[model samples]
Target: MRFSATALLALPLLAAAAESPYEQYKAKFQSFLSNFGVAGPAADKASAPATPSISTGKAKKKVTEPKPIHTLTLDNWKDTLYAPVKAEATQPEEWLVLVSGRNKTCYSHCLRIEAAFNESATKFAAMPQSPSLGYVNCDDQPVLCNSWSAGTGNLWIFEMLPAPAPVDIHYKRLNLTTVTSQDIVDAYTGRPDIQWRKFEGYFHPIDGFFAKYGLSVPLGYFFWALGAIPSWAMMLVVSFMTRTMMNRRMGDANRQGNAGGGAAPRAAPPGDGRS
Candidate 1:
């Protein structure tokens, strides 16, 4: 009876000892603190404000603005300015040349002018045929400088007729003491003499064909296939005719040989009897 009572009492103690490690550790810590005369809030009763988890996601890309086109020199003049104009320039078309010096005052002023022109480049591109803008460095190109007579700190506007023979380039000095981007654009577009050439004749059969169908963007491969069909058909027809002719000739030769040749001779029997 005494052993049974002791076992029942030890059963509850063993069950308490089998509790979670966190609960047991907390209980022991609390007991240790109590033994040292230190008081703290109960583990279950105490509440703490949670610290938010910081999430590190992908970094965004940096956006940068486009750099403006600066002053044009003789080396880059043809590629940057003149070539584009030449490719598009029809008869009676012209280019607008902006001439300036490379000195401290003129260079800064020219850059300001160039920046203004660059901003309006999109607007110019929209036109059917717009005058190309170019900068002439007077110090570098003395011949062009003398030809245009581009004075230092002066901005001149010119109409260039890019003709094959006797290249005619005309200039009319602008009366602007203070130049702006809009001023250059206005002067070029507003000029009454700037003539836009019209498409005179059909350059190719395909061009005419597409035009007849009112198709702006032609399917080039479709046209190429269409063009190849006739040649391919001709080649096939020629090959078939040649093959038929050869087969007819072979048949005729066989028929002729059969008609002309006689049966096998009985000479072999006679020769064997003679031997």
Candidate 2:
């Protein structure tokens, strides 16, 4: 009779446990806390599962930064910048590079941000995995700047890939306002919070007519210009050429008449009968 009564009483407790799983979890969590010297009931601690050592992540030892800052000019950009980064790697490597586009005429805009940009570059250069920092002055190296799609007062971030892989441009942001070092670091490590605007000619198709033929089709354009000339314009050219020829012939005749004195006797021949 005693055993039956005990079993009937325990049934309600088991039912409560099954009905509230969250309550059981809470007790287990409390017990886990108790393992860390947190006070809890002995029975609860005894029922808690053994805890295992967990590691969030390993910390990497930071090394000294390299000479990240460089000037990308027309003369050395191909050999210095492009060739080295594009070299094949035993294990694939990706390089993060940041480029600033500025002009001497951009004093009002670029000058203000220039100080902050330099400060950020100094900070970024100290990072263990520092990014390549470079700048292109449009006026100084217009061709190189154009190839990089760099416009004045703009910043570009690109991921340089190995050979055969095209460079990946991540963002192009106009630097109207100066930013802090933390802001720059966050932007370099991850993406910036603000919306990004594209560089000039973003909407232009790269493989356009002029881009395809370039200098090779220069004379070709002249031929096309000739074909496109209006009929009235062609008539004007022809009229001008004919008038020039007529003037030259008349001039030659005048000169010949003066030199030979043949024009003086023509009037006497005509008036011979009347005289």
Candidate 3:
């Protein structure tokens, strides 16, 4: 039969020759659905949760703070203990701070003592560690001084006047009649080390010129002397001494002529008086 192009195309699709058109159409529809994933229920239920439920055996932990340590003192503070703290000032109201051990720090302790140790006119003596590692200010009302170290522990004793010679303040053997450990700790409204005892009897602060040699005094002297000499004057003195030493070693016999001494006296002219 005579067929137009459209009629021929539609006739074959509708008639189906070697294979069934319906079956081909079904296969193609399934393929398209699979490519886009619209064909079946979503892949297995989103994988089961790795852990269905958490265990309840573990519990939260609590934190604990460190306990304060005991305060150690020297048995014979005046003799056994030797340090720069003795050079500190002495006053009934003044306080002394002692810190030791490499990791030990007395900043807070010193501040608290300063509040109780000072009077309206009290003053703080210069400490060896001052102007560098640390310093004290009696005028600050709450004067704070501290010692930090990683090697040997330092004993610091605060008094109303500067420390005595040999420069050591031992708290252990104070005449336990006046200032006891409890007295001091109690005054500060805190509990210090357990070995507190009241020092009784006459406790006089020692004084002597040797006390001047304490850390602060000598340090000051060194700096003062260092500043007194002018650069040129120091250079001249050093040069002169060096030359003197060198001349003595080299045995410069001619150097005497160049020096201020006059030339050897000429032999008296043969008896001028004879003429």
Candidate 4:
């Protein structure tokens, strides 16, 4: 009878544990997968069309594609910036500008702008900056910024300068600096030396974040967070100090003015009033 009672009491505790938050999360994730038409837990082990099965006479198993992952680096910096050139009378063409911080291991990939290209007499320009896309236009140039995800990476391509009235743009990559202005003119009938400029942008330092947790966060996140600190704090501090100094100076000036005998005594202001 004692054993039976203890067993019955333990059953309720086990049931409570089974209904924990972790189990709830598992249930919710399963439902999410179910909505996508997969057979919950057995989706990986089942012989379904989406899950490819391989058999070697002795055993059969389902195969799943590997998941893609982004690398977290402390020293790598892949940030980039772009600045486009404005048109001038002497230089009547636009140029694409690019500045990128290099990564120690990974090469910066798919670095390009997305803009319109056509035959025109005036210079047209489009630029892209890290965290934003910037552009400069001399004439009423048409430019587009399109970023499409191609598989695991992004695709960015655009035009810098429009071609002459007779010629049209055939390729998207504008390698004008490498080629002479006359070459560009010959390639597109009267277009001048419209080139793409590139430079280095701000890069996040590696191992900068580990200091936050006492475990030493990566430098990249640390520098990034430090850079994002509010500028208003510094401005407010400086303004406060300035105001304090100005007040002290004004107080000293007031003391000096009082000591300088600037105020005359009301001598006999009104002998006529009351002696």
Candidate 5:
């Protein structure tokens, strides 16, 4: 086909218009801009600056802190209980303390008491006013027990106050020998001048072990026997194995000696015997 230079240039532009969407749009936009007497690039730049910026001014929420729970210990006993009572001489807040033996020795009862008192304390603390609840180790703090008329491995209630003297403490023993967590809560919340009966004889060692775990006497003995059986069986098996190994070694030694003795003695030298 024959074509002029201008026509060939027009052919490339037509091909671009057909193949590229951007070029086609630009050509149409430039036509509209020429009709309106506006430059395409400058108009786009001027329109960009006309868009408005937005501000929300959103703020983050603040979190509230929780209240702390208090439990009595040897270190804090003086500061939380004794010091307060001593400082406030005539009028002092009521304090509940459970005195028991060393944790290792009386862990079961001590743990039960502690858990109960902790629950009671949490409940009481929610009220308008609540007395302090605490635990004391009799072994660690024998003097405190004596001063408060508390015996080791037993729960004691005391009313403490600051007097003209060093301290004024009154003991209030409960009537019941065995007390639960609820019992303590009731006693603390209820009457202070309640009558108390003397505790009977202490429990026997075996009886106490079973009682502490809330097991019947027969059941406790059965479990004890059950625990002992495995140890006894293991000891018997070890003894039998040792005896068997020893007997096997002795038999082997005897067999070797007998075999050596039964063998014929070496013959005398042939030349010496002939002479």
Candidate 6:
């Protein structure tokens, strides 16, 4: 009778937990997601309640799974892509792209964007399981700049996990309120929800090719010059050989004409008859 009553008492709790929403359970991480603008209003509303709680009969050892293949932001985003990381690896590796130039041509907004990227990148690079950071100087290397779909004076974030792993890499292009130091860092780390645009890389387009291969305009020219130098050299050699052959022919003709036109043939015949 006691066991029957106990089972009856636990029935409502089980139903409540089973009926609760999934986001309500991940309440701990929701605030951070909201701040980063990753999870939007629906998530914001769902995070009030903690994760579902169901009675398991006996105490189970708690095990937390390491988050893997994260692009696990607000769930809906502008652009998302995936690549595989190698099997044997050491630490987390990621990238953030700053699509701007350093020359005199770089505008005021470009400089500001770079500053924000640099500031956040530095801090991110130093953290535990931190990611490596890099950028492009569009003035110096324009070929690859178009892939991120960000024009001069904007930023693009990339998370590269090159080492071997069971999961594929994820890339998220996020949007935010403004460009400021640590703004990108915050964007990457996860914060309040913000409106973002997706990056569309195209292979048919010039910029798309560069983005797909991570190449640049200057690099293309360098490759062209490599092949061109050899072609030009071959042409010069052929021209020189033709000139030498023509000069030899002209010298031979001049000698033959001098011998034919000279009075030497008559004198030689007279001397030989006298001998």
lDDT of 4: 0.34
**Error at 129, model 3, angstroms:** 25
Please report, in order, the local distance difference test score of every candidate based on alpha carbons: 0.53, 0.58, 0.37, 0.34, 0.55, 0.51
**TM-score of each candidate?**
0.35, 0.43, 0.21, 0.21, 0.37, 0.35
Q: List the residue pairs that clash in candidate 2.
A: none
Question: Of the candidates numbered 1 and 5, which has the greater lDDT value?
Answer: 5
Off by over 4 Å in 4: 1-192, 198-227, 231-235, 262-275
What TM-score would candidate 3 get against the native? 0.21
Q: After superposition, how far is residue 235 of candidate 5 from its true place, in Å?
A: 34
Candidate 2 lDDT score relative to the true structure:
0.58
- Write the residue-wise lDDT of candidate 2 on 72-188 in tens digits: 675675344455463565432333334443444354566655565667776776767766666666656555544444456655654555644544455555446755556656766
Question: Tens digits of per-residue lDDT for model 3 on 1-275?
Answer: 77688887787667675468766877887888899868744336676446568779888765332121223232223332233334453422223443322112333334433232322112122222211011233222111111111112122343333433222233322222243333443333321453433322222123423233344334334544564578999999999999999888677666755674766766966766765
lDDT of 5: 0.55
Residue-level lDDT tens digits of model 1 in 158-242: 3333433223344445433566666656767665464322222232111233434644123433443344467779799889999
At residue 70, give the lDDT of candidate 3: 22
lDDT of 4 at 10: 94
What lDDT does candidate 5 reach at residue 109? 52
Count clashing residue pairs in model 3: 26
Candidate 4 C-alpha lDDT tens digits along 1-275: 25787788899899888889778898899989899888676546466557567676775554433221112122221122112322322322222222121221113331221111121111221112111222222111111100010111111122332222111112224442243323323433323343322211221111122222433333333444444467898688789999999999999999998898877777665566665
Separately for all candidates shown, the number of backbone clashes (residues 3 or more apart, or on different chains) is 0, 0, 26, 16, 1, 19
Ranking of all candidate structures by their lDDT, best first: 2, 5, 1, 6, 3, 4
Error of 3 at 63 (Å): 35
Give the C-alpha miss distance for residue 64 in model 6, angstroms: 30
Residue-level lDDT tens digits of model 6 in 27-137: 756777888779644536666777788887998766433222222111211122223334354443454445566653364446666666656655764567544454656
Q: Where is model 2 poorest over a 10-residue stretch in terms of lDDT?
A: 199-208
Best by lDDT: 2
Better of 4 and 5 by TM-score: 5
